[model samples]
Target: MTPHSSAPDLIPGDLPSRWNASTPTADDVPDLHALRSRHEVAAKGRASAGPEDTRSEVAGDGAAARTHVVVRDADGTARGWATAQDRAAGRVLVAVVVDPDLDDDTGDALAGALFAWAERAGVAQAQARGLAATQLDSGAFEPDARQQRRLEAAGYAHVRTWWQMRRPVTADDEAERPTGPGVRIRAVRRESGGMPDAADLVAVHDVLEQAFADHFNHHEETFDEFLARLRADPGHRWDHWWLAELVDDGAAEPVGALVASASLDDDGRTVGSYVDYLGVLRTARGRGVARSLLDAVLTDAAARGRSGVALEVDADSPTGAASLYRSIGFETSYVTQSWHRDVVVG
Candidate 1:
């Protein structure tokens, strides 16, 4: 395996004299946020992920090996940003966004360069892992035609579509939460130290892993890997997690899991909550496990004075999860598509 210290330089050599590339840092958070916000507003009519989310993704709590690149003009102003991380063996995630204020031609050129930079970084990550090839995974909002065209230009294929859904919160929704028979939903147990019990945390992981075993892009992550990625997120709150269980004869078996994070507004206020992941095991499919868990999320978000909850669901789910979410007051706000490319390490 290639050593980290000996990793290849990812910056393109063909950049104009007025531009330079380097790994992103906390200082780039603002520029990164602005770049992403521009895309957000253009695609979804408003922004969702705030500065902290960008900060954490750029230099936050992630166990996965990653490298980020930001292009700056001669004035040292950030003009482009991209993130490429080795999420798992043979799987790399790349997110590339350029300054939206640039003229069309300059913006397109910068984007192409950044996308190429991310791909080369992904290859290095795969090589470091001693892999022959790796799959580069990236996504774009459905409305972002520019991003889609660029991804195709970078040799990525459109693979999957997801529904970004949201539901406004109200006291009445919380007061009327639904429950499942023989099932109970609650926060994962915490020890006296205010940290969650390791056992319960593992149960949540197991439930999620098993729950999504048959789902699309089902890459099994090690427990340590799972913990590091979530904990690194700035919006992650312990209280935002819930586990649904089947209780009978003095024993409880976890059947569903819901992991959520804070949704921040422009002024850094907690405006809503985002459901990062929600899953129910096959054995618990018809038992209302998913609904019970969501009820807990909606109730908690509402009680906290958060405006609403947002989540992404597979647009083509065989289980009709999007329909269920719609019936529960969630609306399809926008759509996003995943693009992937498999590349051999040089």
Candidate 2:
């Protein structure tokens, strides 16, 4: 990790002399929001990052273990931003956003600087954990040519494509409730202390772990880490989580799980629900466990008068997850590409 220094240094390669990198602070939310908006518009012709989204990323997370940096002009105008954090099992998620007003060469150089910072931070995190190798995870919208080039130059490969899908909530859709074969869906059990039951929480984590064991870039995260990450999100709700059980002759345990969070509109109004995870054990895949869980969440959202439900799926998922979502009226809103590389640290 680079030591905290206030001096300005030129980023190697083609960036203009006036642009310098510095650590970011909570006061930069407006600047970060502007950078993200310009990046989104240049890439997708639409703005995706909202003020709340930017604020949460900039201010909500515990700051001790994460790296946040921004690049600004000599006049102190923010031009780019980047964040690096350890997420999942052994993966570091690096996100970079650059203002589109800069020339192509300068923009590319800014991205390279951010990527280099991310790799250094990621390698350090892996070494601290006594791990030899770690995965670097980042993404780009399908249409961002500049970002695609930067990722390629940074030794990241295009690993997978994902589709952001949305389903409209209507009275008719709610009426078509799903009926799984002896499957029961209910909220995660809570203890007397008003916290999620430990055993049930572990069950949910286990189900998800086993379910995605064969999925792309599969990594096993500790149950404690899983719970911590979910609870860290501001939108997390206890009642929004559901467990699926297959009952035969009155014997049952959790066979699947569904987790969701509140989704707000651009204006920060609660508008819908977002499916964070929907996983079923391999042994329970064909028993309609997933369908039951999805229907349960959709029904609950409709009852609350939410606009709809949104979820992301691997476009080429071998489990036919996208097909199932399509059957339930999920339409693709946009696509994103996942880029990855493996870094080894001594």
Candidate 3:
């Protein structure tokens, strides 16, 4: 499924001789955002790439500290881009996007070269942290056959699929919300100046850590990293966060947490609420904790006059999480696949 390019100056790895690669800067946000949108529309038949999203990806900080590179044509037009981040010594996340209008060969070459760069960068990151091994993880559209073939050519294996789910906001969506007895749901506590309370943040992180312990690709993320990541999002707001507590014998325990963010349209308008994370402790399941947390998000979104709610779920989750979302009105919008490659750099 490689793209056919008539260009005669193909390099050893199929990269075109006329193309140049360089690090992206803040000035490239507009162009990069457009490139990402084109790639998204080509891969998923929809455009969700926004300028704010591009800005965050380039300038954000946290556990997954990313570095970006852009590949430009001879005319100085950006034809492709790749970004990489490391969660740990051997665990890395990489993303590659290309101009959909480019020839198949150009697309293949860009992906191939960028993937190689990603592997090398991931190894260097791991070694700098004193690690002995490296793993490069990336994602692609399930519908893009050429991209899949390109990934396979670069030694990556497709491991998981995720469904982007969405539901329209309605006044009746939270009509029957119930947290059951001894359960309470409330926003994360804020200080006098409207700053989030540190204790509440820690509680939310703890609840999430315990909730996702048995989930797929679960990793141990520090509380600081968790906070930094959420704050790094352009749409993040402390008021959009919530915690569900269980009261037992006058002692309150945080059993669940929900993080919501504003989803912006391509024009920068707030269109909906994105359920960034919804987690409930194993011991808190079947007690309406997840339901209550979701209800809070929907109700909050409706109150803010936002369009609806959106989230992604593991398509093959053993807990039947997708079913739960479907029961509450969410439906699959699109599907994406995860690919991984392991490199030994010791």
By TM-score, the best candidate is: 2
RMSD of each: 4.2, 3.0, 4.4
lDDT of 3 by residue, 1-346 (tens): 1122332222225556666676777777777888998888888888886788888888554324787777777777778887778664458888888798999877887788888777767777888878777778888888988789989999999999999999999978645477768889999999999998989999999999999999988878888767777887888888999999999998999999999888987677898999989998998888888888888898888878888899999999887789989998999988889998878886
For candidate 1, the per-residue lDDT at 336 reads: 89
Query: lDDT per model, in order?
Result: 0.83, 0.83, 0.82
- Indicate whether candidate 2 or candidate 3 has the larger TM-score: 2
Give the residue spans of candidate 3 off by over 4 A. 1-14, 60-64, 174-176
Q: Could you give candidate 2's per-residue lDDT for residues 161-220 as a string of tens digits?
A: 999999999897566475698999989988888988888888889989998898988888
Q: List pairs with backbone clashes in candidate 2.
A: none
What is candidate 1's CA lDDT for residue 20? Answer: 74
Clashing pairs in 1: 61-232
Prediction-by-prediction clash tally: 1, 0, 2
